[model samples]
Target: MTTTVARVDVVAVASPKRRRRAPGWLAVVPLLAFVAVAFGIPALAMLDGAFTVRDQATGATSYSAENLSASLRGAYLTALLGSVKLSAVSAALGALVGLPLAQAVVTSRFRALREAVLTASGVLANFGGVPLAFAFVATLGNAGVLTRHLGLTDKGWDLYSFWGLVIVYLYFLIPLMVLTITPALDGLRTQWREAAQNNGATTVQYWLHVALPVLAPSLLGGLVLLFGSAFAAYATAAAMVGSSIPLVTLQIADALSGNVLVGQENVALALSLDMVLVAGLVMAVYLPLQRRSARWLA
Candidate 1:
């Protein structure tokens, strides 16, 4: 009897998706360096200042939570909470109103109209800050043309109020949401809608069962973007209302100028840290949702 021996071999295969080229990585160095210089260093310094305290007489330095603790109570806490509340309310309103408006623009049969609306959105999205505040003041302030014409001021319209700020924010934020969500709306496959229809799904049913589930990530991502925009905003609020409203950004300004927080301490560093933490939290939620949405849209 003749016996044959068989040899077995194993080979490891690398995935193309996991492979990285040296030059592609090299190209990212400049951007990484810029971020390190522009953001990382300043952030590190701010963090150091926030924790470190120096004795006025002895010149002895020690790390402490005094500033941070101070910020968590009284006016500083109120400002922080106010910022969060404003961001949440404005973002929610912007999403609610802007989504249907964006959808309407997307579904419209007129190409020219769609193009015009999108171009306007692009322009308006960036149209904010002092100029925006001024525009609103001129149009909706106590002495504004529309206010005078419609007698809104007599009806108790106050432009400096929180709700007024929401209305002002929506001016740009609605357009921003439109600009932000349009591409995602476009990514929605017409075939999916037709398929849903083929399965005897009504308009409401299709949206409820299919469209909304797919769009949820994008919607949430947009909400976070709006939140960040509203949260970090300073100039418009500063110019419009000054310290009339307790905002974290306004508190930061006051803390820097020796204006003294309600408890007679400067916690600018601590407040900055707080803002950074809040922003970081927003990003923590935003980045993953954005990545997931991008994967789906792609």
Candidate 2:
């Protein structure tokens, strides 16, 4: 009886979510169109030329499988093999050396040391092709700094050889690997390490159970990137060995040059083969690791 009748009051409420219209990418369209015309079309045309044979007399381009088949022998094969071997060795060696450096950078006690190391690594990572080749030539080539100091100019170190190429490749690749792998290591959760230690896990145990599995995707990505960079490199090898060392890029350049390779058709085939090989290598790496990459990033 004492309880007053509750006044029933109802108020209309609106939904909290706001409806959104599809975003307009109007500004980026011109830039995309420019890239399509400028870069994409030219690249596709060059690729098409590789399959097509030209008649010098009439200046006509025709598709032929025969020219491509012929390129499998001689200088083309030699250069291609050399390029693959060099890139593979450099990538493997670089990753092996760089992974530990990345670990050090991420987990190091000294902030100043980490910053300095990372900065130096970045400089060396980007220092490739012309500048790198020149620096090494001055520092390690015949009559170079060390050789001159040791009075070994007469006997001289050869920077034009395969071993010399490997040395130069490693010099550039080590820093690259460090830069690539460091981000992966930095992405690891600190809590995981703390938990592992609290659970009485050893350093090795923690790495094997937690760190490595998480970092695998990044590692694979870095390795693939390194391989691609090494495989397609032209200027560094050229500056170091000139045309004496046969390489796919050098072959492509020769084909483009009127003086060196006589057959434009043959150059096209060589370029096509190089492109296919690179594409295959990338696919082999990418197809397997793409899913893993998403998970790792997540």
Candidate 3:
């Protein structure tokens, strides 16, 4: 009788737990619905716009490849080239500068100073756009404080130049890379380092054999993020250099504003192409690196 009663009690306890877990999956329904409504709708609209054209005679919409093709040859191509160049350069610089900073901070004895630097970097990473543009201009533009003090009134580098944009971008890029790389650095097992040291491995050998392999995925991920951020960025580029620098985002803005290229169908197509190209590039780099990382981490 006691054994039977114990079995009955177990069943009763399990019943409510199973029932409670059922509703947990239902919570995802709202999130999925939200994404379908918000992201799915907008993404489809953008894709549809890429192929849509307006009839000059009747003002009716129709499909046209010529619009997308024309953009591919002119402003779209130029903007893409510029974007790639800018992103690549900035990411390279970030990685070069950030890795050392990450190493220093992670291995530092001065924890307070390291924390302060990390906090400052975090603040600056999010501190781009109009205010950043104005700040740079105030310090580096014509008749600015630094320019005036250094007697560089005429020869002072204008904040409206390509290199100027790069410099401003670097201010944020370096900090972002450091933030991303630091987590990877922290994940490095001290055991592995000690093992390598005990095995009579040189510092360079240890880094090349163990640290680099382990950190590869995080490094690649950071580079991809940096590239994507730079590529899609508009505010800093627009505010700092305006359309004179001829970036892809500026061209898109111009298309919308001026209603250029026949009802601005080209703008949508151009943006689609831009997104697709970036997606493709990132995937190309990420998939191979991810596979390698998985294998290594296994």
The regions of model 1 sitting more than 4 angstroms off are: 1-26, 57-59, 261-266
RMSD of each: 5.7, 6.9, 3.3
- What's the lDDT of the predicted structure labeled candidate 1? 0.89
Pick the TM-score winner.
Answer: 1
- Clashing residue pairs in candidate 3 are none
1 against 3, candidate with superior lDDT: 1
**What clash pairs does model 2 have?**
none
Kindly list the per-residue Cα lDDT of model 1 for residues 195-224, writing each as its tens digit. 999999999999899888999999999999
What is the Å distance of residue 60 in model 2 from its true position? 5.0
Compared with the true structure, model 2 gives a TM-score of 0.81
TM-score, predicted candidate 1 vs. hidden true structure = 0.88
lDDT of 2 by residue, 118-216 (tens): 899889877888888999888888857986787655664577888789889988788989988786787788889999999999999999998888888
CA lDDT of each prediction against the hidden true structure: 0.89, 0.77, 0.81
lDDT of 3 by residue, 116-149 (tens): 9899989988888889888988888776788788
- On a 0 to 100 scale, what is the lDDT of residue 232 in model 1? 91
TM-score for every candidate vs. truth? 0.88, 0.81, 0.86
The candidate with the higher TM-score, 2 or 3, is 3
Off by over 4 Å in 2: 1-23, 55-60, 150-157, 198-200, 259-262, 265-269, 287-291
Worst 10 residues of 3 by lDDT: 261-270
